[model samples]
Target: MKRNLSSFAHPVCATLAVGALAVLSGCSSSAPLFLSDGRATTLVQCPVGSDSCSQQASASCGGAYDVVRQSSASGTLSLIYACRAK
Candidate 1:
């Protein structure tokens, strides 16, 4: 007797797709690469008094690097910047 395969097909495919997505997401880096230097070299800290702390940090890199991360603690904002060669 012939049996229907559609019901089993959908759930299995959905399960496999979800699993693949999960694995791929986990493989992604939390902090993406911003420079060819292979590491973040410049760090800047901005006081919380300024509304543009993040902007200030980005500018502090002397227009050469891109800000890759920003964090705040103890009323101070911190940034990690990476410079890429032209």
Candidate 2:
């Protein structure tokens, strides 16, 4: 007796396609990495004595987070931050 295989092919193909899409999407950098407490954080450095330093740092924090700390050393200013969600 010969067994038919076409009936199972579509589901297998669809499953593979979905699995591939999930894997590909997981590799994207657009997604933010959040901490266990649901906050996202990053470090930003800028040149001291520049008015744009704070602006650039805020932009680097994705424009939603607040500047938690600001420090300067040598000629650079550093910003530590966490995102503020609505």
Candidate 3:
């Protein structure tokens, strides 16, 4: 006799999907990355159609900053940068 397995599949798959999403969300650029020398790289997010992200990065660094990487997704722009030392 074959046991009915459909009843258990949906909940298990849903639980696993949610757990995976939670783990992946931590990988987003919202978190800051610190260098070995104590210099920290910040992530600045703004609307994709504006210069706000770059301006924000400059403000965060208090002067100038180097862009480590940048990407735009879902109408949001993400900029990862490290401030230049004075």
Question: Could you tell me every candidate's TM-score relative to the true structure?
Answer: 0.39, 0.46, 0.58
lDDT against the true structure, each candidate: 0.70, 0.75, 0.87
Pairs with backbone N, CA or C atoms under 3 Å apart (clashes), candidate 2: none
Write down the RMSD of candidate 3 (Cα, Å). Answer: 5.5
State the number of backbone clashes in model 3: 0
* Cα error of candidate 2 at position 51, Å: 3.3
lDDT of 2 by residue, 1-86 (tens): 77579888999999999999999999887655566678876667878888665676556655666766789999998876776775
**Could you tell me the TM-score of candidate 2?**
0.46
> Could you tell me which residue pairs clash in candidate 1?
none
Evaluated against the true structure, the overall lDDT of model 1 is 0.70
Point out where model 2 deviates above 4 Å.
Answer: 1-37, 60-64
Candidate with the larger lDDT of 1 and 3: 3
lDDT of 1 by residue, 1-86 (tens): 67599878999999999999999999996665445667555666778667464565456555565667778899997877676445
